[model samples]
Target: MIPVQRVPVSDRTQVLLTRWTGRVRDAGGTPKAAREQWIKAQTPRKHVRTALESMTRGAVRCMYCDDSRGTDIDHFQPLENAPLRAFEWSNHLLACSYCNSNAKRSQYPVNGDGVCLLVDPCAEDPADHLRLLLKSGLYDPVDKSARGEETIRVFGLNRPDLVKGRQDAFFRACSNMRDWHRLHQDADPLADRLAQALLDSPFIDVVHAMTRLKPVAEATVVGPATIPALAAWRTAHSLSFRVGQPRVRRSAASTDCIDGVADNALASDARSGQVRTGRRNNDEPVISMQNYGLTWTDITGTPRSSAVAYDESSAQDRKADLVNDGCTNVEIVAVRPGKLPEPRG
Candidate 1:
């Protein structure tokens, strides 16, 4: 996971923006002054939203679980207890709401190393710090670090449903990759196939995780089954067999052009006694892929968006997928450079 930076804003402006934190409010909801306030607060929305959308570009996924959508503004720390920093630009994130409320709600506890256990969707690499129990469907701490344990305890990693969801995602993602291999083993368009496969699992974290296991290159591409269809395909190429893995990549710190601006914006709002961050930029709330698929390409052909909309199609799409296989219980986990597993060849 990459460390998310707060977009900059002047201290005064941020304070003026926080007054619109009510559970219900939009760019145009309320008294003339309130409406104007909302619009001003949203000035930074575009920058913040753009930064987040860029992170998930090209099939990138959630750092913690299999949420490929990477939607929602996450607080690196809990907003409830950390009130002073609640509107702090650095404290905010773009994450799935499920992750923000259900899996982790103010559950950050620290250890001696000063590393937080909560899986910060914007701060730590989840894979480097933790491992998953494939058979039992549980997440295990890769080290004795305080941050790892806190992540597990806070997110309910051991929760039967959550673990089950991870396991199910793992199985489906493996199946999808295997299917891709079967269909295109001899096809020369490897990159295209790979891209499509990645898109298939917009929120697939399991596939991302498995790519790190030893003997990854062959293992991930070759399925364990000896079924006729699989056997025939492998026999033609003399392929080796093994359990499939995810395609993990070496972690790198994301460029944070939005940080300084975010901090200044938050400070300004806070000083003005604003209850929340303002829309100084056009940044919008991060919605989930489960709710909105992986790419805007399906609708707009790319990541850049001129505006945000909550149309019927978007709503229906989210509901169906959630009912089918997505998790409604979302949580955000921060990932940092050096936290991801090695990618399989």
Candidate 2:
């Protein structure tokens, strides 16, 4: 996962946000307050502009497209419909203009079961429900929930260019890992070796993906024993992650995050080209486990709900409400997983 690093806010920005928060609360569903907030936030320009710059620092590329560098502030929650959450610090995300405009426009999903596919960088572990199509480049939602469909639609996951980019990245990363493994076929000190192997790549997401792809029955990178087990880590933990200015959601007609599969995913396998050349040891199917931010539970057969972060009673009530709104399943990903794991040695 690409790590996310938070930029320390300047006193000027902090002061502005503090006041903005209060103003939004006071406005509380008033059209006038919402308009006033947008005007004030945009007037100086520097506040929003600088915030976008700060958030994209160390950012790899568009989180959705993974092609061009992301350069704008994205509203994690579409601001038009949920103005109350307009200025929340955690709600703003840095994104590329293509993704900001062409792909993800305020489209978030709610399932009949109350599962929201709109990933909260603060709450959800993206790897859980979503998977990047290595060949297709589109981000596919494995579960058939409203959240999944909406997120895919809004993010333009199936865009030809975007999916192709992700597919290229996957192969590039995979090729590097495979080459390293071939070189150290007889290495020792399993844990030390695994650590070094991981350190070789600056991109941890690549490492996680490689780990998931490694031959399951094989040993360490070199021997019969595999390297020490690496726990699931979120892309948000990366030092590269950042925040940006708030966005106002325009009408759905102007929405960039639209429905329908992009041409990439639908492309015939032969048309996309085969996986990059290398000795891919295993054709064995590898199963990916979802890291639901500790707050998620399997309720397929059971009716019990588990609290991931907030109070149990409130969480259930919220889940029910989300379900009522058309979310078929509700999985409350914990925003804060208590203490984050320290960087591994």
Candidate 3:
């Protein structure tokens, strides 16, 4: 299982959910009964499903297995017991029918302290509680008290099919990383394609392991310096190396400026007496030229920045340019006219 970040739901959807729950309360039925009743309603049901799909970034893979498509919405706390939270957004998670109906059907066990035994993938990092056995393609609890054991047993995470799938994903990711290392410089286009494939592949934990293990030296075509270059690339593109979670998407204002080309250019212009400022009237709107730059990390932990643009649209254009150049985790931020605060050295 991987960690999933929750996306904000639209107010319209929130109102619909609130109204549905209110109707359930008015009927005086159990939460489970209410769920059954409401799920049969086509419009609201579709809205909830569409919202869930968007939250999962359109992959809509089962939160428990990450292997199968999520076909149903599973209540984190069983509706029979926690009726009040039945329609709570935080309590709903996408699950495959197998994991929902067959494996974890209404089983909500608690520990001695009354803490729930199941791992909440959204609230907790699964890697902290579970460790993947690369050789066996099986999941094991990090320790005896870790909730991973109960989660795996309840969700059937180590089932034969899942184990086999994980193994295949692991091998495929390793092979691709090796190819990426070999062709990154001479055949960059192909390498970028391989990088994107690795990014989009299921079971990203396996891909992250490949980067950490640095096993590309075993490839017959690799050289002594390949490991360092690979490491550098990985550092530059830390966003791509993230395992067990979706890539972090920062707002344009919060994104880091990688290259200083725009800043340096503006500084050079100022030094060369190219910049001029004047106010025609007290209330005249300032027409200062603002520059925006596209910034993103590569596979390695290096910061990359683009040339400055005169407007936000130009910044978006620069972002597209980076995308066309095979960049991932790209963002456009204002770099000049109104310079963003710089990080303390």
**Cα miss at 224, model 2 (Å)?**
14
Give the per-residue lDDT of model 1 (tens digit) for 71-143.
6555566544443333345455665556656777556677678656576544335665667655456778887
Output the better candidate (2/3) by TM-score.
Answer: 3
* Model 2 lowest lDDT segment of ten: 249-258
Q: What is the TM-score of each candidate against the true structure?
A: 0.48, 0.49, 0.64
Worst 10 residues of 1 by lDDT: 238-247
Off by over 4 Å in 2: 1-13, 25-32, 42-60, 112-115, 143-146, 178-208, 217-345
List, residue by residue over 1-345, the lDDT tens digit for candidate 2: 233333333333333444565677787855456547866775223454454444332343454444466676676767766675565444556677987877776665666775566764433455555655444455667566455566667777677765555566555544544544443232211322333334333333444444444456224332332232221111111122223312211111111111232334323321444221111114321111111221211223222232222323344554554354343445655232121112111
Quote the lDDT for 323 in model 1. Answer: 32
Per-residue lDDT value at 237 in model 2: 16
What lDDT score belongs to each candidate, Candidate 1 first? 0.42, 0.43, 0.58
Instruction: State the lDDT at 282 in candidate 1.
Output: 34
By the TM-score metric, which is better: model 1 or model 3? 3
Candidate 2: residue 204 Cα off by (Å) = 8.3
Per-residue lDDT tens digits for candidate 3, residues 22-42, read: 667776758666777566545
Off by over 4 Å in 1: 1-40, 57-63, 68-71, 80-90, 112-115, 182-184, 188-195, 199-203, 216-345
Model 3: weakest 10-residue lDDT segment is 250-259
